[model samples]
Target: MKDTHKHQGLRNQLVKIISEKGITDKNVLNAIAAVPRHLFMDSGFVDFAYQDKAFPIAADQTISQPYTVAFQTQLLAIKPNQKILEIGTGSGYQTAVLIEIGAKVYTIERQLELFKKTKFFLPKLHYKPKKMVFGDGYKGLPEEAPFDGIIVTAGAPIVPNALLAQLKIGGKLVIPIGDEVQIMTLFVRNSEKDFEKHELGEFRFVPMLKEKN
Candidate 1:
């Protein structure tokens, strides 16, 4: 749990790398600088944490690659205090990044082991989400309807209509859609019935699975 000076230096290096790769949002980069990326993984692999690559975590999940997180977040154009629903809460790393940039996050994790681990882990780092739920990601949190933005960390075979329905009109849904290799897709709700769609590019992610616990 110790975030040493070495760790901070590594994080700074990571920020520079992602910025060069085209993450222009200052807030996003600042959030990247603020979160201790190394602390998100098992200590043995901490050396690779600042390399902008995805690494394995509990429950057979991989912490998303840094560029992928930054890309999806930059697309959302997060504003302070905006409500954001995150479909997967793998390492709680991305949630921490969102919190750093000032979005109020409500994250759901389907894997019980990772969910439990992250539930206790995030707050230890002092990154608290608005809500952390153990449930199916496909079924967005309807009770907390009308979020300003929604991000799905795992690759969905198809966009979950429930997620789109949960967005406020003018809200954005950033998800990766496909099988094997997912295309980063954005859906912006224009009106109650009109939503705009865009496919940015392809990235690989663990599959979004059904509820098991």
Candidate 2:
């Protein structure tokens, strides 16, 4: 009972921060609140989960800052039961968020170590995806084409065309694009193969490196 109380208290604090920072979607707020951020972080850093900052998990990568995750998720405008494709699973933190919001998530991670780690950890959080691929995220998940939404956690020099191809018409894809500094951009698939883009704002993230399997 004490552990549960601690978890809920931490979640409420995060939700309050998200609200004050203009994260208006109640569903998004609740989803973020529901997922235990501490579970996705290192045990030594569990107390830091509610802070509005990113923390190193493993594999030389860091989980995204809370606001960044909320902002990107808000841009996606996820609806209940929508099919979501996530590129760069990282610590599986974003994946848990998507699942909490009732999305059927399919995630792809290029790094073998992160992929394996996320695969093991995700189920422990009760947020395992519908499908998880250990392959190049630049390729997207072609077998699971026509996803309702796509989110990329890493910064890329340019948006991968393959990811755009996987979006359903009227579907949204949120990604961070640039070399050193990045601008989170939103792409809307308007037709069979056409997409329109809107740049949100500047953000920083680790580069999305392709791993040869």
Highest-lDDT candidate:
1
lDDT of each: 0.93, 0.89
Give the Å shift of residue 102 in candidate 2.
Answer: 0.6
Prediction 1 global C-alpha lDDT:
0.93
Candidate 1 per-residue lDDT, tens place, 89-192, comes to 99999999999999999999988889899999999999999999999999999999889999999989998889999999999999999999999999999999
Give per-residue lDDT, candidate 1, residue 23.
Answer: 96
Model 1 TM-score? Answer: 0.98
* Candidate 2 residue runs with Cα over 4 Å from true position: 1-3
Per-model TM-score, in order, reads 0.98, 0.95
Which residue pairs in candidate 2 collide?
A: none
Error of 2 at 27 (Å): 1.1
Worst 10 residues of 2 by lDDT: 1-10
